[model samples]
Target chain A: MQIYATIAELVSAAETADLSLSELMIQQEVANSGNSRDEVWAGMERNLEAMAAAVKRGSTGEGAFSKTGLTGGEAIKLKNYRATHQSLSGDTMLAAVQNAIATNEVNAAMGIVCATPTAGASGTLPGVLFMLQERLNLTHEQMIRFLFTSGALGMIIANNAMIAGATGGCQAEVGSASGMAAAAAVEIAGGTPEQSAEALAMALSNLLGLVCDPIAGLVELPCVKRNAIGATNALISADMALAGLTNKIPADEVVGAMKKIGEDMPQTLRETGRGGLAATPTGIKMKMRIFGQDRDFE
Target chain B: MVLNYKSVFDIIGPVMIGPSSSHTAGAVAIGHAARKIFHAPATTLTVRYYESFAETHRGHGTDYALVAGVLGLPPADPQVPNALTLAQQQGLAVKFIEMAGPSPIGHPNTAIVTLSNEQRTIEVAGCSIGGGTIEIRRITVDGFELKPSGPLPILLVWGAKDNDQRIQTKLAKMTKIMRQQSYNTAAKHLVEFDLERSLQQHEVDSLQQGAAELVYL
Candidate 1:
């Protein structure tokens, strides 16, 4: 059997196999690895449980402080504020953003987290999934299905483009992550596989050319905040796709474009901590303050 | 190369302790793989951090994580941060050399590890290919490349001169071998094979007494 390398092939495979994207992924896992479908689902459920636990631990405000004191407490503050104030984005979206922040904050604090794609981009999928669980009243099995759907899309992107910041900047990291989350959210919201692809395209296109420049070379600072933004982007893009929106460019083409942009990007911008926000004067000051002195880097 | 996203866990999680997956978890995996290939923790170790890893490994906890892995700690272990001090108290001679530029093989996140004991020396080159996934590009023991992926149980049988008949006949009886790779250098003949099941301690000892060494990954 041929493996699906592009979104079009994936969608067509799902259609011909008479499977949803998530089902197609489950089938592929069985065929490729020779594991039973139940085994694969059990492993995914374990990850889901870990993600939920991280989210809960992170929202409690304790142990949120990162080593460098860069990121912490924002998730707790967001959760606390939502209890008393009427959030313009409403409770679900606010909770989604907070959950995303909480996951990354935990990650920055050296806590365990399920890296949705990578640790730096870990928060987006869990944030969107848990919020959708409450807002849509999704069952645990449905949430697992949502993960499979997202995995299907992420597989295509990772195979076609990249997912590491060192390889393709933040666009490939958080951008690919958000695209995966958006597509999964669409699937949970009753969007077709094609609409999920559309959501992925829109989410990735919006984050194209985004550089990977964490201040002081830590995954904190802008990274934690980027997960929050990525979660919001996933939610909005998913909604847009559900409401009959489509991308001008196809999903595979968008992935190819991202690969090209990453190739063309200067080495400094691709997580070298030499350009973008990392190069600002304040970035240098923070690095000096954190490390106590500057080391030689030529 | 086609990136393998075999399972949903590959996409969603490794559930690791981290600041960075590529730097921390991946580094640990490489070191752990080195330990496996060495079969025992080395008394002295030399690690070369190349390119981006050399520049930013400190901030990412790559150094401590790699040492923790060498001590046989997993990525999720909370004891990772104390690996440096632990290595010292254990009396392991550890040296870190910062290479000037990208590796000659050209991966940005690459580590070349040299592990040595009184009896043997092993050299392994590995790269952290993001999200706690790694590729063991090359492994050289006694000047022959013994390529093992580091996840499977591999028995390295060396010093058997006759590769065609003697080694294969013996290997066929020991266990069911899934994959095999062979290399020949000046002094010895080496064959590495992944077993369907792990060998007993007696089997390992028998293999080691007969051949040069037996390594189970």
Candidate 2:
């Protein structure tokens, strides 16, 4: 895992090792943990199972409220809406959106979720993976491979730049997860590693400079809904890469750009919940209603 | 690029109950660590959320998560959200204070807590370093600081700086000992060091025989 710090290194290593990104990541995990291949794979399989259960609870349950009373049943509503109406985004995209919403909703409700980097951005990877699972009729092996591939990309971002909003803004959280999902989706869709790398760049470029400002400082509000967009972003980027489109900027440079942008952002735009949507009139009202105090924000 | 060797699972999984991993799971880790190091009964707990944690504590369940951790609840426990009610049930009075504006230093996500019982009080300063990882920056048992209280086994002693040699000798006999810090006052010195492995209960009693207090974790 420490061997490769950037996507360029990852791709080259894949080529040299004559292995796919997922295979290389699995090897690294095996070497690092001194665990048998079966044990590592089974451990990730458990995480996937937990992810699926969260989606089930969020999309099917009568919709529980978060501690803040913000974020809960939107996932179920979207699921119901997709069932009855012709979604403008089409079934697969809509399904991904709902699934993304479901996992984040589960997080908001204090249900268990596997943080794909961080819990605030947990939904994007699972959203993209499960949708591909259903759409491509992927086996458990393929799904686990998707996760490994996603983890590989996330590792690069986490190593070279950041993945937590507190350090890198929403661009680091949902943005990193989206990029990871896009690259993984491309690989599982049988696109070349180069194409997957291109998708990674494209997905990150689409959401660069995004801020992390959850109203009332909760992971509800924008966080859950943003993951839906992240899932869709990954989908389009994967499609673009599969069609041979590429980013002008290299994937690693794009990640570097995101880091710079996040550094330049004011504290309010970070996870302080001080500025952006968190500072909106309605946001302040909600905060007062929930916590009975306005943010001491200037 | 500065490459931090965070595991792929660090990117993928803690499988924690959360709205925000840093605020909830990281906070839980801090409280849990503080309690593990305190290793004593706490009648009252006072927590101060700093900077980013202060602003977003309530929304992220940082409050419940911290209290839950002190109550020995893991981040995955479904009861984390119900921590406040549970605290009341157990008669642990918890106080929370949120401070706005920027943190002067350290990580933006930070929490400082004091857990006090009848005879003693333990103070801990912790930072949630994102991705559900935490840094137990300062763990103080009655002003005795534990330096480098990381994942390593720690043996902290509060006594005379003169006893530092004796304690080192006793510690060396038990395991490999590397002394880290010894902060001394007029009458007492808080000697701190990391141990190769945990010390036995009888060994701890022996170390505390002439010392004011000794905590082993």
Best by TM-score: 1
Q: Which candidate gets the maximum lDDT versus the true structure?
A: 2
Alpha carbon lDDT at A55, candidate 1 = 93
Return the interface RMSD of the candidates, in order shown, one decimal each. Answer: 4.2, 4.7
Clash pairs detected, candidate 2: none
Clash pairs, candidate 1, are none
**Candidates' C-alpha lDDT:** 0.81, 0.83
Reference contacts preserved by each model:
0.57, 0.69
lDDT of 2 by residue, B25-108 (tens): 888878887787677778899987777798888778899999989999988888988999999998889988776555533668
TM-score of each: 0.89, 0.85
Sliding window of 10 residues with minimal summed lDDT for model 1 chain B: B1-10
TM-score of chain B of each: 0.75, 0.72
User: What TM value does model 2 have?
Assistant: 0.85
* Per-residue alpha-carbon lDDT of candidate 2 for residues A261-290, written as tens digits (9 for 90 to 100): 988988788898888998899998988898
* Model 2 ranges with Cα > 4 A deviation: A1-3, A67-69, A295-298, B1-5, B141-217
lDDT of 1 at B152: 39
